[model samples]
Target: MSALHIALYVTGGIAAYKAAPLVRAFIKAGHSVRVVMTAHATEFITPLTMATLSQQPVALDNFAPPRPSEVSHIALADWTDVAIAYPATANFIAKIANGLADDMASTTWLATTAPRIVFPAMNGHMLHQAATERNLNQLGTDGVVVAPTGTGFLAEGYTGEGRLLEPAAAQDFVTYVMSRRQGRLQDVHVVITAGGTQEPIDPVRRLTNRSSGKMGYALAAAALQAGANVTLISTTGRQPPFGITYVPVTDVRQMQQALTARFAASDIVIMAAAVADWRPARVAQEKIKKQPGQETWQLDLVRNPDIIAGLGAQKTHQFLVGFAAETQDLIANAEKKLAAKHVDMLVANDVGKPGIGFGAEDNAVVLLQSGTAPQYLPKAPKTTIAAQVISAIAAARTPD
Candidate 1:
């Protein structure tokens, strides 16, 4: 690829140090680069260090002394081909998502029209929080590409998915984005089911699962980044990321109906929701009263609709992916499901495994393809896992 102009935005996170090496990589790749930092980011790393490494003076404030013009933000915004925000803080992410230009860094970000990418770094708990995840989804919807965070030691002394990407990985992602001639998944319509379906038994009582919906949300975000039109079907109360059309359902039947209506228009369907297997035989119109000695009351249950299998039966040309969450004999059970559902691919994980299952930010799964040995992925964040799944699906669709 020819040398291109690049702008690097640093945020306040422990991973800010990674920006130095990232700047070096872009220089080594024959690209012209400039560095910009949020005021809070300066507390983590010095401008002098980034300047020395990038061979360009780091721009900190929108209006610094001796500028030829007062609008430095506009000048910087207009000069870049691609802009990247590394170690993007949750605060900055939310601001960008909401179009808030409260600071120089955010103002420049808002002023730019170039393709933007964000590499988020934070504590695992913050990364998984409802608000942070929602902002990330919004960024994706707004056409900003997010590189998945890695798992490792955090400044907060905890370990999980909020670690920033290694310098090498971040560089590769930048190159891939800048070198692409055409967007992947352009004009493709993708429907993704995420989180777990809830089955209400009473006004307040319901049955749900531990699914956080991170994996499915990540898939939708990635699909949007790859230039695909995405529709997210979710049962979890979390909001869908910014770029997706969301359809929320509380029961398996409702989910089935939603999918049935959209499946024909979709080029791909990923059934990532952990739908309830059974539901109450009757849902009381009002809250069931608790009476003395009522603990012995019995309620009947019935099997819920089989969403994936139904889609598989009705699907003709669309690619279908299913997920299998198992406790024991994971592969064997997943293989059975693969055959039973006639899915193009099955991602199976052992939820019993520590730190790699439901309600956790990371997951270790095996991708199963018919007549081929299963491919195992070590424990990693759901975002990275989603990327792997997206790559696999793309490869499967490639002509031999």
Candidate 2:
């Protein structure tokens, strides 16, 4: 993530002390922060403390010791890239929701064009009050993000909801919100498949490949960081990170079924799973046993359905991406599959090379698109590769 200019608004509440760490967290993450505080907030945590942490003077008054050239509130509002209200009291929440900017903090919020996030910190009862709920809902309608209050011990000597989030968690929430705003694929629904599918021959035996599902998982993570809602379908048992929808499948048919169910609603589909080309024509209920005279056994195989091609044929508004792990004639074979599968982009790599493809942590790939020359990406971590692929997809889908 890139550095950001963050405006932290401190409101009155016992949780106001938490704002200091939040400021440090943002700065630690390479963001510059400027704090604004309400009168009640000053009682809980001194402006000097915030100023010392943020390395900037805190804005505490609408008037007094004013600048000669510009209004402080408006200047701060205009300078902000993102606004955050930490430990927002019920009074402050209502004021912003209703556009009552009696104080400098509220006024700056009203005047700012940057996106806003509110972290309500009040008594559990006050937070769930009808009025507070209505105000929060109004803020949502006004395009403000309201962070959910954590449930835990409160200042009222009781354990319940409406507790402030820890500095680390709050920082994480801010990062997520900021990423979504800056992300090119914001609100895009993406579906990706990973790992190698298995074709069962009998109850105890199955056929699979060496694909470790690393590349596909990388794509899912990259897309998510780019603010796309992602669904990951995999045969591997690797646990997905938070914020991705996961569906586990064991074979080509199961993967195909999962993809088909989500294809219509997706804006982009990436076929990265190394699906089996063939499966046993019949599955035996029990494991095959060796016999005295049986030296060799024959298994009947049938072609598995081409998953990507089927989705491409049915695509209405989705951008399709397919992957090819080839051993020889990489470019020619990949290009052939690109056109055959009807994908918008084809990512082809030579699995024959050691330490780069299949189960390797790094990859080198040639990106293929219709009528365009192959673009080679040097060997790099799969995460880096995935980010580049997502960036390329975003550029292709929304050309200037």
Candidate 3:
């Protein structure tokens, strides 16, 4: 286990008392923790209690004297490996979401460069409010790991998803943030495809898959954090991280062309796009009208150009990865594709498995290498899986 330097920010909520136990858990896990309490949070839990548990003086204000000339907030912010806000109130959540820095807690959050996690706690109605939901969604999109609140009684006498996550779950999030391998893909170029390709059938009608592009987007973010320059080629409308270059394509042929043009420039290519396997033989000039006997109408379909196979055949020294989303004979089919496509590695998953494919945020996959037993990865957040995949790539590149 790595020695983690943690900064815990306590926000006002009925669950503020839970932060004490969390601090203790971190101490027990052999981490050095410092607690920062908002003025309102000090009402629910005293600084003495926290300082005693954390074995460090709790810094509650930006004006506090630092060990050096550095400001307390800035020093503490720099000292932390991961920062977390427990029992984040609706007001605090909005403050961070809107970039408000009225208090020490909010200011420290803005100053911290470390990965941040927030556990929200509030009244059931507040949690369900559209503004709150929007704020939470935005936070996730901004790459903050949020521990989902459990459904239970709130201090306001209502029962819903406003309770802070259990101590175990909070600790799990802390572990995750601290355990990530640092700068593993430094200076690498990663190209990824995402979402389902739309094959036009008419002016409006089209053929598409259920892919929501979560897996591909997650991979892009992970690779980016690992220090790789990422270009996400996606068909889904999901907005990628701020700095990544995104190329959107609506059909298989367009995607093939885009890949062909960009493949040689990328150091690593991950074909996560769910390109359509077939398309209408002839697209109608306009929307086909529904007639009384339209059930008898026929349409022709044709196979799409194989983008992955083309890249595989022409691939030189770069690492090429493929995704095999299968329902059955998973390993056998994936292995066949690995050989047929001449890929460096393949990620095979049973899409039919619950919570592992399509729009789901979590996934499980088997990493297939030529002549080696597939490495099984259990269902995890797409970000975690992406990091694992990138790590494997780095390992493969290491000299024997």
Candidate 4:
């Protein structure tokens, strides 16, 4: 899966110690984390420290980019896939609840179009105060997802409510909230194929493409975040993001069998895996050893089943999306596949391009569908492109 862009807002509180683990958890799960802290939060934990852990420069003040061409706060807003106020102090919560944007944290919170998640932490009485209660309710009214405060020992000697949530719990809550956002593909099952299926020529040798499964994994994660029931079928040894039903396959036959088993239950099927077009016609009982005099060898090849075309022809209610990676005659070839495969949409790209597509982190593609005009996706992170692709498929689905 492509890395998630997280904007974590840190505020002053003893619970601030928990923020480090929070950031670590996000990173461990393959998300990109950036800390944005209030001035007071600096006293509890150093910006340099958080920056080191997150591997991103912490934003302590909201200002324009050093270049003076772009507004820094808005840029952050657009960059964030989700905004989270971790260990939010009562003061910080009140400030945002009252429409205050005096600091970078508040300003970024106010500006972001992404979902906001707030973790309120403070002394029990402070949290129980009528004004604080009102502010918390106000935030809820504003559609901010608030995690339930855990009751435990406060910073003081006396025990009371207001403990920061456990890092793992907080992480799970954030993921759940993000999935519940608007336009969720709730109840829809999406089956996606990823990676390059290996065609074994012998026990020790195999033929495979350059696919790393980054784009397909990104699509699976994006679909999950969109609240779809995602089942990922992958051949690459790469890991998929959390929260998916994964089916692992190695060769052409296994991939075909996996897709056949899963496709019947899916609402959308994306054929992103670079399945081998041909396989060795004969299988050796063991690894084929080379003789010292053997300079040339011949192997017969046979065509593998056209998985996408088979699905497209038999698909009844499913939205079938196929992929084409061509080096020449791109448009005409993609259009021909779009028709011949009977796919609803085809995502095509030129693997010959430099630094994009085919195992790269970024890609540029042309989307061709039966009805809509061709849509071009500029070179960007695979996650962003996957999100757009998932949305287009969702938008095109016929209603019950």
Best candidate, lDDT-wise?
A: 2
Error of 2 at 384 (Å): 4.0
lDDT of 2 at 386: 96
TM-scores, one per candidate = 0.62, 0.73, 0.62, 0.64
Among all candidates shown, the one with the greatest TM-score:
2
Better of 1 and 4 by lDDT: 4
Clashes of 2: 0
Off by over 4 Å in 4: 1-18, 21-173, 398-400
lDDT of 4 by residue, 1-400 (tens): 2357999999999888889989998998899998999989999999988999999999988653544776778888899998999989999999999989998899888999888889999989998999999999999999888788888877887888877788887886777566755445977899999999998888889888899998899899888888888899999766565467889999988999998988888899999999899999988879999899999999899999999989998999899999999998888899999999999999999999987868899998899998778999899999889989988788778534
Candidate 3 vs candidate 4, TM-score winner: 4
Candidate lDDT values, in order: 0.86, 0.92, 0.85, 0.88
> In model 2, which runs have C-alpha deviations exceeding 4 angstroms?
1-3, 12-31, 37-68, 98-104, 150-160, 163-189, 195-231, 234-250, 276-304, 313-317, 326-333, 350-363, 379-383
Count the clashes in each prediction: 4, 0, 0, 0
| TM accuracy, model 2 | 0.73
